[model samples]
Target: MWDACPIELARPQKCAISEDRDKLYMDFAAPLVSEDLTLVEADPFQLMVRNGNQTCTIKYTDPSNAILSKENACVFAVNLEQHVESDLILSPTRGCKVLANRNETNLFSLSHCEKHQPHEESHFVQIKPHNKQCHTYCPESNLTFEGVNGKCPNDVWVMPMNTNFKINDVQFNGSRISIVHQETLDHVGSMKANMHLQSSVNWISLMYEINRSQPDFKPLPPFELHDYTHYVSYSFCVVVITALSLIICIVGKKLNNLPQSD
Candidate 1:
């Protein structure tokens, strides 16, 4: 007699896959085996990755898209962080205010009183960038004349005046005059008077007053007198022609008066 034998086999284990690709997929029936697996995620600005017990961070703009891994760390794939808005505003028109004063000799202070009394001018006022100093002139008079003292920087003392002097309308030595204030009557004065300072307070102040009355000031080119080359050439030609005519007249007169031999 022979006995019948029956055997039962084990069923395969079920498997499940994670929705996120960053996670690994495995089946219950699969044997546990150690293998290196890398999970990566990317966005416009940055890249993140996770590997066996490690995390890697990368920038999208990097020249090479090489994978980076941490020595020992955990990785997280997070949404891009929002950047805070800047709180800065710009103005349409921007400008700076400047106070400029011209330095001059025999500089007088003007009174804005209705009577307009002229103060006894003592020391010359020298207004500068940092401070104002009282300078003494040669004669210490209202009509002060500046000379080449050799102490001035340019070897000349510039007389800056807020008076009526039309430097633009005057001409000198093959060059135009470039006065500080040309258009405004308030700053116009005789170039000679300004250079020589031979005018009275009333006259000088009048020029300054006129300039102040004007609303707008437009600079004019200084007067320039150039050499008259054409005139000189004409004169030279006239002299040459006159000399030639004189020689011809003398020769004609000698020929006419020649002695006749019979």
Candidate 2:
């Protein structure tokens, strides 16, 4: 608990919907400081999971087993084997998420996001059988509004996880820690903090993907964001109006000062 709020994190895991909609699988690295939030050292944290009737703990560590560990840090895995015919709501009795505990807020170690989010619940619908016509349906998801069928044009789900080198040594000057890195993919998706003795340890997770489409590669949108009319200047209108006003004023002044018609 860095300020009494669970520090948020991200990991690459197989986030999927259940086949019977009764349970799901979670496999990801421990939550790292969110690139979106203000960060100070990426010190590893821990978790106390309460999932279903079973319980387990996992984490990612560096190859040498150092602070803010890596190599698949903080792994939270839950497997549910319920094959039902219809879609069912996953009750806490049937299954639950592996949440984090705040008993040791001061302890720095690698842990899961459930620690940051205490009231997070997840659910998934089991894949239904294909009809005689060989047609099936997709589990309801953000990607599918009314739920799609086996004929969904988009069938790919990718989760990218990564393990960059941890800061072995840092020069702490009061509230910030100083470290350096050369050009590499690790530099992407992270925001550098300008502080002394404080640092935002960006944790990268591996990529997990599920492709439900055909083997042949195909463009989904068939267009890029720039492909559409996408130029937006919040002040463009004002600038144009100001320029027009200046021109009009200049022209009006010239007309007023011109020799009077006789």
Residue 134 Cα positional deviation in candidate 1, in Å, after optimal superposition:
9.3
Least accurate 10 contiguous residues by lDDT in model 1:
62-71
What lDDT score goes with residue 25 in model 2? 76
Judged by lDDT against the true structure, how good is candidate 2? Answer: 0.29
Residue range 21-89, candidate 1, lDDT tens digits: 577655433222112211222212222222222222222221111111122222222222332123111
Model 2, stretches more than 4 Å misplaced?
1-44, 47-60, 65-200, 203-262
Q: After superposition, how far is residue 54 of candidate 1 from its true place, in Å?
A: 94
On TM-score, the candidate that comes out on top is 2
Q: Cα lDDT for residue 207, model 2?
A: 10
Clash counts per candidate, in order, are: 16, 41
